[model samples]
Target: MSTESLGHNSVDARSNGLFGVYVHWPFCAAKCPYCDFNSHVHRGAFDEAHYVEAYAQELAHFAKHTQGRVVQSVFFGGGTPSLMDPRSVGGILDAIAKHWIVDPKAEITLEANPTSVEADRFRGYRAAGVNRVSLGVQSLREGPLAELGRKHTVDEAIAAVRLAQSIFPRTSFDLIYARPRQTLDEWQDELTEALWIAQGHLSLYQLTIEMGTRYYDLFRAGKLKMPDEDLSADFYEMTQEMTQKAGLPAYEISNHARPGQESRHNLIYWRYGEYVGVGPGAHGRLLINNQRHATATEKLPFEWEKRVHARGHGMVTDDVLTWEEEGDELLVMGLRLREGIDPARFAKLSGRKISDRQINELKAIGFVETLPNGFIRVTDKGWPVLDAVVADLAA
Candidate 1:
């Protein structure tokens, strides 16, 4: 990794050992109809070179408060990180190592689309310090992909996963389920096929209608037909049953992995650890000098770059957490994991015990069960009913 200062920024590494860095690349070949992530498709031009510099500048800004705090992981997530030049990624990694005490075994993961244009960057990413790869192979079947607005062919997805496994020892890919008219038999066969190709991990999600997406618009117009709740519930239960038998049990809501192969980067978020977010519209959570903070950068490309050039930051907001805010954040994120919350960990952030009244209410409702190990966990029975539980608990 090579190094450079995009601009002047001070660093203080003794913040805490609970830190990590996130770099966002905000361009995708095409935005899926259902994808509401901060991604866009370019028609004419993109300033990749200048965008890379902006990322380093933003990182330099945060590293000051995060010096000596061990970077537990670095996730290259986005529009499509695979679209980035290997040199740009290399330069960023070098700069990170220079300013922060990055753990040598730090988990570095890159999210990629399976097209040849992006897949070809795998080896370069590995060379650039990314040891793990999460390919967005959203479907193993072609029809669902076409319906979902993805560009790659099924064969292309298969090839990309195979290539990724060859290049990196740890690989994870995703599959979207619960499509309209998709039967249990069809999805069961696909899952069977996926497991044959799966390596150490997988992320399988039940499709949901996000408000601003194209699907949502069509849904509002009543032109699109989606699976009913009953059918969707069956698909969700089937996924849990199948994945558990395959030995890659669900570690979080939608993520599954073999023992010790869980996604370290995602765990950073689910575990409520600190990380730096750089790039258009990326949000990060950090704790600095005993104060927890939420950070988000400017969302537009031109605006983010200009802001970075001016004040050496593109931050849209930098906010410290209130006790109620911290509790809400902790409960929401903590429940995403199968392990639920470690009471002591909750106490560390909120400086108060988790309410036994609330715990008893949830247990009584069959939403969560107390474990013998002293960790509270969501029950398999409560998986589908999670949103209601979270909302009531928060209320």
Candidate 2:
């Protein structure tokens, strides 16, 4: 469908509501020891043009199912989306605009590494319609940078951030705290520097050893030193206090942003909005035939490409969620936001109300509280045990 014809339809597929498109680029220059994401390092050259074509076909395939939706955001996430040629990025975007009525003010973001080479393309990405950039600057310390398998130096990371801020309308960078033997004082100093460099957004994540990563193997072998439970709690509290004081408060548990600078693409996921995922290994939540369905694509890159060419899409799973499953997912995602969940919405999704006895018991222990407007949220005291709180409420 042409953009003009698509625009003429006033029915929004879900207009007045949140909808998004996520494009996953699964190639990375190198894999980090701590990451378990679906990323690969190709030893030889591959056809970038062919892959871009697959992405376009997949977008068209989804467009047929979600016709007339006004896309509120488009995110180019990856193993490393910055590695993509600017023309490829532009091609994928053109395909998106071809199939749907992309909102004029839609937030378009790309995730990039902080290498100088990638930073040089910031202007090109901007020219191609990407208005936001999120850099993977895991650390500012030289020692930790090496330990984390990051190729960029601290100086290079800072330079990239500065360059991105100058080029993009919005920018954000990530930092991983709670590293081995990281003192509270050192983190305070480092984060202070980061806030000074930050223009509007920061994603501060605590280090955790997930299975299938090198860090997990090291931890199992007792070769890795992790902070004890108490120290980790101290780190979390310090992070909350410092970012809140910097006016970039934690809108979600791991993401902090200046008012109105929050990542709109990510908000779609956390707020339980529908989105279509394109590309290998991407997962999506979509509203189909008035039912919420969970969809996933093949994880292997070449296999996914072959499937896309064979059947016009690479989707391997599309399960319709039960009402109870919908309620559970809403809690799993919505509770991550400081704004919390609506009891009425939960009842509507689940066909049953959350147990009042559970809420009262948790509140008695200072784990949760009802807002002045009747929204229920986990208190700071409860954030450390958020999973338990959600489980109790959902049960």
Candidate 3:
């Protein structure tokens, strides 16, 4: 497979079928205050060898149900997958290859932090067959980094990114904006610097206080203040303007990439393609017996390992979705892309069409627009209130 057109455009809603595999590494060096992800910080040495064996077992189990499917992408996401030994990553990738026909040009990515310690393993990971690495560089400023409880300094993050660029075929980093007390000018400066150093892809996310996170408690206690909606909107607009000017445009709500440089793993999800999610707290969507099924596993790392050992797979939920539910989910995921949702596909899935009343009303207000290909996308005016738009259309 050629690499030239892999990231050229968003996945076609009606075609470009994709299959992916996601492996979650549930261990973090230190838990961030604002993260609600199922990542645990282990004080004592854990059984890395045991976990690797369990992962292989789980992959074999999934392969049984998904035989003959070709995997186009594999993503190692987590509490911090970089914490795992590079050899362990290699073993898992090997297991995947043993079961499924992994595309030779498949996008294999590993999520990492930018601490110097973790960056030291970049070459090892490259040798392990990970062609892409996404760094968790939440901020470029010391103040925000400290506030976010990140261990790496801005200097370290930049160095790690440069190093990854040197080692991997592709590299991307993340940034959090709309943070407490962050000014527009400050973000613009930071983002400008980020773009200058960025290779092709970036993920700029607006901070949200999720339930059960320490940030949520602080927010409720009046100790932390998020950017006001108006200010946050301004930040969002500024981000779009700056990234577009830099040649990377918003391909998804929070993800920006040059044409064809988008993350293929995430595209699998947004395109509503089939993928198996293995690891604790991982979620999967698979098509079996002519129906799409949603799958989730136990959240506890050790518990999931035990279940995988005992039951061959650690799935806790395997609910077959109804056509209506598939339609709603398709709309929800598809509309997130700049490419938008294919109305004909939605109708085919739901056995009905999206309300013309809803589409016309939104179009009249400049909140949604139809593509020449008959796809529908949220406009800049609608992105800020995307949930409402999706609900109105789905309803």
Candidate 4:
């Protein structure tokens, strides 16, 4: 495609007013047993150059549709972006700049496994324009790391975090709590240490077995023991309390950050802003012709590459969402934020207002509350049953 043809089309007044890009690098050194993300462990020789070229092509294709949009955030999510050569990461960022107007202060984040080997590449990634790094330090204990199929040990993970903090402008790491046989006291100790080590942000998630994961099979076979409902609730509450006391409050359901340290890229998603997703199994929401289109690329890595080579894009589906669908999506994503959703925006997008009776009922039951600023958000009591609350509101 010619550069001229990829330039911005006529601007739409009904745009979401924010835009970003998501690049999916779908390769991993080893697949975690609990992971259901679209990541594959390739056995044969991989051609990094060819993959990089395909990414450039696919990005150019997306640029044609989303021209003139200033990129506020560019996320390199993965299988493990740290596995990539820094030059490859640089090549993709260069491609994005070539196609779109990247903001000078755009948050360029790359997800990484906290292995010592990958941590060695920290300086290279920082030199290549990655301002932020989110490490996959799933556990700080050896036994749980092994159980989760993570290749890094506790010492290595901590070292990686320290190294990343020294190298990058912003750094965040994740941890999984409420594992089988885990006690509340143990978790409190662990979280206390995590809070002490955390620089500005942390992602703490409760372990849940998803179908098609090895953990799910083990759970179904009764070989895995998970925390029961009450204990899980205790874990969640304690996590909230500790993180809040540590000065990193929960910004979303699973994310915590100090003031102004929230992940801007993820906030784009939670705020229902527009983004282009390029690469295998990536999904995007774009505003086109005054309508929101949901797009998804082919899932298989090699197949997506082939499609991109042939068609300049790897998209497998592009559906124009209805107003109701748009409103529902806004509710689903926006409610996860502490700032909550704007009912006016919801009405503008969905063409209807939320039922007052439903809101009154939920408020009476203490599931949700209307902020003084006129935004509606799930309360602490409501977060445990968030899906049900959303369902009721949507209904």
RMSD of each: 3.9, 3.4, 5.6, 2.0
Candidate 1's error at 283, in angstroms? Answer: 0.7
Worst 10 residues of 1 by lDDT: 1-10
Considering only N, C-alpha and C atoms within 3 Å, which residue pairs clash in candidate 3? 7-260, 8-260
Assess the local accuracy of residue 323 in candidate 2 as a C-alpha lDDT between 0 and 100: 90
Off by over 4 Å in 3: 1-16
TM-score of each: 0.94, 0.96, 0.96, 0.97
Reference-based lDDT, each prediction:
0.83, 0.91, 0.91, 0.92
lDDT of 2 by residue, 57-103 (tens): 99988887777788999999989999999989999999999999999
Best-performing candidate as measured by lDDT: 4
Q: For candidate 3, write residues 1-395 as lDDT tens digits.
A: 01231222323333336799999999998889889999998889878988889899989877877777889999999999999899999999999999989999999999999999999999999999999999999999999999999999999999999999999988899999999999999999999999999998999999999999999999999999999989999999999999999999999999999988999999999988889999999999877655677889999999999999998878888787898999999988999999999898898777899999999999999889999999999998899899999999999
Off by over 4 Å in 4: 1-10
Better of 1 and 4 by TM-score: 4
Ranked by TM-score, top first: 4, 2, 3, 1
Residue pairs clashing in model 4 are none
Q: Rank the candidates by lDDT, best first.
A: 4, 2, 3, 1
lDDT, residue 30, candidate 1: 83
